[model samples]
Target chain A: MIEHIFPVHPAAIFILGALVIPLLKGRLKQIYLVTLPVVAFVNLLYLPHSVFWVHHIGGFELIFGRVDSMSLPFGYIFIIMAFLGALYAIHLKGSGEHVAAFILVGASLGAVFAGDYISLYLFLAMMTFSSAPLIFYRRRKSATGAGFRYIMFHLFGGSLLLAGIVLHYTFTGHTHFGPLESGGLYFYLVMIGFLVKAAVPPFHAWLSDAYPEGTATGSVFLSAFTTKVGVYVLIRAFAGADILIWLGAIMAVYGVVYAVIENDGRRLLAYHIISQVGYMVAGVGMGTQMAINGAIAHAFCHILYKALLFMGPGAVLYVTGKEKLTELGGLYKTMPITLILFMVGGLSISAVPLFNGFVSKSMIVAAAGLQGEAAVYILLVLASVGTFLHTCLKLPYYTFFARDAGIEAQEPPRNMLMSMGITAFLCLFIGIYPAILYNILPYPVDFVPYTIEKVVEKIALLSFTFLGFWLLKDKIAGQPTISLDTDWFYRKAGTAFMWFCRNPALAFAGWVDMTFARLAGGFLWFCRNPASALATGVDSMFAFVVRIFVGRQRHSPLRALKSVVGWMDRLSLAAEEAAKRRAQREKMAALAQGEVDVRGIDSALFLVALMLALFLLYLAVKYLW
Target chain B: MRYLNNSEKKRIVRYRKHLFYLGLLLLALLEIFIPRDPYFWFDGLPVFYSVFGLLGCILTIIICKTLGRYWLMKSEDYYEE
Candidate 1:
C-alpha cells in the first residue's frame, strides 16, 4: 500500500478553492487559480492506495476517498486537465467562469473517488449543473438555448441514475459501488444513464449540440470532463457488457459519418469526440486486462489531445470571432503556431505514429482483432480513416490552408498558446513512451504498439486515406448548412411542446379560469342582496311549475307564489328601514354613518341563515343515510 | 504573414503535391518489405490496409454526403425555423 501524505479528499481542494476565487482579483486570482489544480495534483500523488475516509450515514457507507489504480489514472488526468484549462482561461476578467470550472473539476474528481452510489449520484448531479455554466457563459442566443438543452439532457440522465441507484439499494440492501449484477431493470437503467453521459448515439446529440456553443476556453474544459467521466463510471460498473461492444463499434463510425459534412469547425471536433470515445467504450466492453488498460490509456491520452483540438478551434474563434469552416480559411499564414499545435492534436487523434492516440487507440483495435471480432475491427478502423479524413486532413485543409477567405486574425493570448503547447508536448511524450502511461494502468500492461508491421500498416492506411482525400477533397468541403442528428427529434419536439403550451394548454387554462370567474361573479351577486335574490329565484321556479300546470292564469299558483315572494322581500326591506330609523332615533349618527349599513347587514344575516339551514339539511341527509 | 514570401510559398505548394505522392509510394513499398503477423483472414492479404483506407474514405464520404443531401442536411437556421 502506498503511504498517505494527505488524508483530505482531492475534490475538496477544488471545491473549497472555488469559494476563494470571488475574493481575489487580477494577478492574484490567476495565481490562485493555477495553484489549485497543481496543489490538487500534488495531493493526489500521495493518497493511500486503499479506500480510506469512509463514513456512515443512516447505516450506509459514504466513501469519499477511494484511491486505487482505476480511480488514480482518472484523478491524475482530470487535475492535469484542470491545470491546463485554468491556464488557458487565466486571461479572463470575470470570476464566475473560473468558479464554475473549478467546481466542475472538483465534482468530477468527487465522482471519480466515490465508493458508494449516493456520493456518486451527488457528484454526478453537481457535474451536470457546474459544467452547464461553461456553455451558458458564452452568452450567445444559441449558447443559451444549447445550455438549456444540455442541462435537460443531463438532468434526465441523472434522474435515470438516481432511480437506478434507489432500485439497486432496494433490491440488494447495500449502496456499495462496483461491478453490478447484470440482467435487471436497474442494470440497463444504470448503463443507459452512463451511456447518455458517454455520448453514445441516440443519447448523443446533446454533446454535439452544446459543446461547440461554449465559450472558447469553456469548451476546452467541457471537452475534457463530462463524457470521460461517463466512460469512467462505465469502467467501474458495466465493464464486459456485450451490448456496449456493438454500440461502441457503431458509434465509432456514426460520429465520423456526421463529421464528414459538418460545417462548424468546433462541431466537427465534437463529433470526433464521439468517434474517439467509441474506441474507449469498445475497450471497456471487451473486458480483457489489456483492453481495460487501452480504454484508460486512450481516455488519458484522449483528454490531452482532445483539449488541444478544442483549443485550436477555440483560439481561432477567440481571435477571428468565427467558428464555421464556411466563414474561415488561410489562417495558417497568420496563425502558423496555432496551426502547428493544432496539427499535433489532429495527428494524435488520427493515431499517426509518434502521437499519443497511436499508443492507446491501437490496443483497443488490436484487442478486437485478437478477440476475432472482425466486424468490430473493420468498423473501428474505418472510423479511424474517417477521423484522419476529417480531423487531420479535411479540417485543417479548409480552415488553415484552403482558398483564402481574407479574414483578419492574429494569434490568440499567450496563455492559450502555452496551454496548447503543454498539451501537445504531452501527446507526443505519451506516444513516444507508452510505458509511463502503461505503468499507471489498473491491470498489468502486455501490449506493444510500435512493432514494424503495425507502423507500416498504419502509415500505408493513413497515406492512402490522404490520397483519397486529395482526389475527392472538393466534394467534402463544408457547406453553409447543418447536419441533423438524433437531436432533431428533441429540438422539433421542444418546438411542438412550446406550441402546445402556447395554443392548446393556454386555451384550456383560459377556459377553466373563465368558468371559475363566472361562478364567483354569480356568488358575489347573490351575497350582495341575498333576501331579494332568493325571493326572485323561488318566484321564477314556481312560475315555471305553474306555467306547466295552469298556463299563466291571473289566480294561478304562480301568482300566489310571486305575491308571497314579494311579501318576503318587502318584509326584509321593512326590517332594514326599521333598524335605520331606530339608529337615527337613538342619535347614533356614527353607527348610521359607519358601523351600520342596514340593508347590507340584513342581506348578510339572511345569507348566513340560509347557509346554516343548508348545512343542517346536509347533516340530516348524511347522518340519516 | 511575414514568415514566408509569395515565391517561397508557391515553390513549397508546387513541391508539396509531389512529396505527398512520393510519401504514398514509399509507404506502399515499406508495407511490402514488412514481415507479416496476420491477426485475421483479411490481414494476410497484401496491401489490404491501403485498399481499405482508400475505399473506406471514399465510401464514407459518398454515403454520408448522400445521407446529408437527401435527409439530414438542413439550412443553418433549421432548428430556429
Candidate 2:
C-alpha cells in the first residue's frame, strides 16, 4: 500500500502563476516562467504516494488528491516531462508562449498526481486550456486554425465529461476513481470523454494538427504528457472494462494507417502517437493483469521513444525551417547522431525484436490473442505493418537517408540532440531488458516480454514488412501528398459551413441580423406609443425584440393596428346604422388565432406608453439596448 | 485552377497504374484454388495486392478538373498571392 499524502490545497498558486506569466515584465519574465514549472514539479513530488484528501461544499464531500499506487508512474513521468519541456522551451524566443507551455505542463503534472476525480478534472482542464498557447506558439495561419480546432474538440469533450460526472455523482455519490462497481451509460460516457482527449480516432484531428504546428519544444511537451495521462486515467478508472480492448485495437490500426499516408513528417509522428495509444487502450480494455501491465509499461516506453522521434524532426525544423519529408534528404552526413537516435525511436515504434515497442506491443498482442480476439489480432498485425511502413522505414528513409537533396542541413545543437539521444538509448535498453519496466509497473510483474517464440515471430513479421518496403521503396519516395481523414469533414465541410453562413440564398442569418436591428428600432418606437395596456397581454411582444423579422411578421403588426383602428372609426360612423341592424343583428362568432380588439384603442395607446417607459428604464440600467 | 499541378497529376497517373496491377494481383491470389500452383499470378504480377484501393486517382482528377476551377484551389501561399 502506498502512503497517504498532503490533505488541503492552495488554489492561489496556480491562478497567480497563470496571471503573472502574462503580466510579468521583460528580462525577469523567463526566470518566473522557469520557476513556475519547477515549483509545480517539486510540489507534486512532496505529496506522499498514498493519500486521500477531501473538499466539501454545500454539505457535499469530494475526496481527491489521494495518492495511490496507480498515480505513481504517471505522476513521476509527468513531472519529468515538465522539467524537460521547460528546459526545451527556455531557449525559445517567444518568452510568453514558453511560459504558457510550462504552465500547461505544470497543470498536467498536477492532473496526474491528483487523488480524486474533481481535482483531476480541474488540473486536466488547466492542461487542456493552457495548451492553446502551444498551438498558437508559431502564430501562423495554420497554427491559429489548429488551435481553434483543438479548443473546439476539447470543449465538446469537456461538456460530455461534465455531464457524465454529474450523472455518475447522482448515481454513486462518491468520487474515488477505483475499479467499476457500478454500471450504466453515465460511466461509459465519462470514459469516452477521456477517450476523446486520448486522441482515439474520430476525435484525433486536433492532436495531429496542433502538435505539429507548435514550436519544436511545444511538441516535445505535447508528446510526453497530455495523451499519456489520458491513457493513465483509463487504466486507473476503467481498468476492469471490456470494450476498450476493441476500441484500442481500432485506434491502433486507425493511427498507423493514417500515419503511413501522411506527408508532413511531424504530422506523421503525431499519427503514430495515436496508433501507439491504441495499443495501450486495448491492453487496459483487456481487464487482465498482463494487459494492464502491458498498457502501463507500453505507455512509459512510448512517452520516451515518441518524444525521441519528434525531437529528430523537430531539431530539423529548428535548424532547417522545414518539416515535410519531401524537401529533406541526406542529413545522415551532418545529422548522423539524429539519424541514429531517430532509428532507435523508429525501431522501438515498429516493435522490432529487442526494441521497446516489441516488448510492450507484444504484451498487448499476447493479451488480446489470449482472449481470442482474432479481429484485434489481425488488425494489430496490420497496424504493426503500417507502423513500420511509416514511422520506422518511411520517416527516416525520407528525412535522413533518401536521395540527397543537397540542402546543407546539419546536426542539431548538442543539448537538443542530447535530449533525443537519451530517449533513444532508453528505448533500446528497455527493449533488450524489459524487467526494468516490468518491476515498476502498478501490479505484480508476471508476463515475460522476451521469449523464444515471441522474438522469432516479431522479427519475422517486421522483417518481412521491411522487405515489402524495400521492394516497393521506389514507388513510395520523394513526394508530399495529403492523406484523407476526419479532418476532411472539418476542412471541407467546415468551409462549407462558412459558405452557408455567407450565402444569401437560404435562411440568411446575416440578413436577419440586419433586419433584426432595424425591427428592434421599430419595436422600440412602438413601445413608446400609447399601446401599453393592450400589448401587456402578449409577453411575446416584449420578447419579440429577440427575434428577427420574418417575411409575414414584418407587415403583420402595423397591419393589425391599422385594421383595428380602422374598425374603431367605422364603429363610431356606423353606430346609427348598427341600431337599425340590431333587429337583423348578424352576431357572427369571431374565430381567429389571435385576439384583436377594436374598442380598446385608448387602453392600447396607454399600454404602449407604459411599456416604452419601462424599456428605456431597463436599457438605461443595462447600457446596451 | 486552370489545370491540375503537374506533380498532383503525376500522383493520379501513378495511382491508375497501381489500380490495374493491384486488380491483376488479386485475381492471381484468388487462383490459389488450383491443384498444382503454376505460380503464374505470383510470377506475372510486379508488386501490388489488389484493387482493394479507393479512387484517389479518380477523386484527384475530378477535383482538379471540376472543383479546382471554383474552389479555393490557389497557391500554397494563397493569401500572400
**B1-81 per-residue lDDT for model 1 (tens digits):** 369999998889889988988887887777777788888988768888888889999999999999999999999988887
Candidates' C-alpha lDDT: 0.91, 0.70
Global CA lDDT of candidate 2, please? Answer: 0.70
Cα distance off (Å), candidate 1, residue A329: 0.4
DockQ of candidates 1 onward, in order? Answer: 0.77, 0.04
Per-residue CA lDDT of candidate 1, range A218-294, in tens? 99999999999999999999889888899899999999999998999999999999999999999899988888889
- Candidate 1: what lDDT? 0.91
Kindly report which residue pairs in candidate 1 clash with one another.
none
| Per-candidate TM-score against the hidden true structure | 0.88, 0.70
Candidate 1: which stretches are off by over 4 Å?
A: A1-4, A552-625, B1-15
